[model samples]
Target: MLRTITIGSCVSVQGLLVGQMADGKVMVRVDEKTYVGYPIPSKRAA
Candidate 1:
C-alpha cells in the first residue's frame, strides 16, 4: 500500500508503505531510499 507522511512541518513524502515504528512514525520507500515520518490522517467520506 502507498501512504503519505510528513517529514518535518512543511515537507511531505508519498511512497510505498514499508513499516510502522513504535514511536508512531511510519516508513516509506520512494526509490532506493526509505524515510520515516508521521503518517497523515486519511479523510473519510460521510
Candidate 2:
C-alpha cells in the first residue's frame, strides 16, 4: 500500500509503505531510498 508521511514540519512524501516503527512512525520507500516519518492522517471527503 502507498502511504504519505511528513519528513519534518514542512516536507511531505508519498511512497510505498515499508514498515511501521515501534514509536508509531512509518517507513516508506520512494525509488531506491527509504525514509521514516510520522504518518499523516488521511482526509475524508464529505
Q: Please report the candidate that would top TM-score against the real structure.
A: 1
Please give each candidate's TM-score.
0.96, 0.91
| lDDT tens digits by residue: candidate 2, 1-46 | 9999999899999999999999999999999999999999999999
- Scanning candidate 1 in windows of ten residues, the lowest lDDT window is 17-26
Cα RMSD of all models vs. native, in order, equals: 0.4, 0.9
Clashes of each: 0, 0
User: Which tens-of-lDDT digit does each residue in 1-46 have in candidate 1?
Assistant: 9999999999999999999999999999999999999999999999
Residue 27 C-alpha lDDT in model 1 = 100
Candidate 1 has an lDDT of 0.99
The best candidate in terms of lDDT = 1
